[model samples]
Target chain A: EAGVAQSPRYKIIEKRQSVAFWCNPISGHATLYWYQQILGQGPKLLIQFQNNGVVDDSQLPKDRFSAERLKGVDSTLKIQPAKLEDSAVYLCASSFGRTGGKETQYFGPGTRLLVL
Target chain B: SQKIEQNSEALNIQEGKTATLTCNYTNYSPAYLQWYRQDPGRGPVFLLLIRENEKEKRKERLKVTFDTTLKQSLFHITASQPADSATYLCALGSDSWGKLQFGAGTQVVVTP
Candidate 1:
């Protein structure tokens, strides 16, 4: 019944620093996703996880970004050695399941990251 | 490479009128198309979704039409109000489930 929840609604770090974000998805949801949204642009998928296993991560900057869904209920996305260009809102979303067609993604408030 | 596009310019309309936004794609056939509304400082909220086979879907005052041949989707909001003012994004699903390609949103402002 609860919506997706994300922590550290706002984050500020200098370039070359590290930051991490946490998300609690809706109960029973099995599909989770992380997205980066720059101002005036759509949210770009960074990675996707299906119950602790990654399904897609081609867009993720593996050199600096990593995410994990330990127990399939919650997820964490981390960015290390941040660049000034890494400044954006990190959004976490979840869906009902893999087989649910046209499954709507429920989003959290998102964590705003500012790399100075 | 697949590409999705929405009007980069903001759309401004008078309240009680119908507001229409467009999304166009190229180089890929989508299985389904989705629309979401986003406000400043928040994440996008799902609004409507229409499958490739479906030509149109409606919810209350919101309507979405998808044309695979044209590779476009149009989102409409009837009797628009200030509350309807926000950035609307269109998304197309990838071959794999849960992988969606999104378009840059079109900001709509309904002025009374």
Candidate 2:
């Protein structure tokens, strides 16, 4: 059973530059999620997708951050004109079922981004 | 406003001892609570989940207790090992869709 997979284990960019991340979830998983984890803090949900449709994205920074889950299998999260504070880890997680809040989520290694 | 807090200070424990961590929240009645283990530079891995109605749950050597009255959760790792060293996070889920609010996390270092 393969877990969620992400690309570019680490990234470094200057402030105001653009960065994008990719995520490939586990097979047969219906719910996908993207979270931002700052240093010393737990991961914060940025967006959630259920079968290619966005379930929630209230915490997403609409002005600069955007994500898409096409075909409900793989997803991407992008941040443009990034700020130094955006330096953090971006994690992708997936669950086999959407049984409300009870499903266990499998996480990827995450993409660590650093904005200078 | 809702807030979730974990011990900001790290817990250092010897191997074969029990490691206990706490998670406290305010202004929110979560439907369920979850605990995760996060290694340095890696994403968190799910450990356990306890609903509001459940008082305690266990998996192998890990035990989780939820107290809705106090709005707190306790995570315990029994017979701890050096491999248990990592940051532990507690997340609260308030909605049916599984939206979660996470705490700052507590670092645990188990030395052999």
Highest-DockQ candidate? 2
> Which pairs of residues collide in model 1?
none
Worst 10 residues of 2 chain B by lDDT: B93-102
Candidate 2 CAPRI level: medium
Across A4-76, the per-residue lDDT of candidate 1 in tens digits comes to 9999999999999999999999999999999999988899999989899998999999999999999998999
Clash counts for all predictions:
0, 0
Predicted chain A of model 2: TM-score relative to the true chain A? 0.97
User: What TM-score number comes out for model 1?
Assistant: 0.98
Could you report the DockQ of all the candidates, in the order they appear?
0.69, 0.78
Model 2, span A2-112: residue lDDT tens: 889999899999999999999999999999999999988889999999889999999999999999999989999999989999999999999875666677888999999
- Give me the runs in candidate 2 sitting further than 4 Å from their true place: none
**Tens-digit per-residue lDDT, B1-112, candidate 1:** 8999999999999999999999999998889999999999889999998999999999999999999999999999999999999999999985657578889999999999
C-alpha lDDT of residue A100 in model 1: 43
lDDT of each: 0.93, 0.93
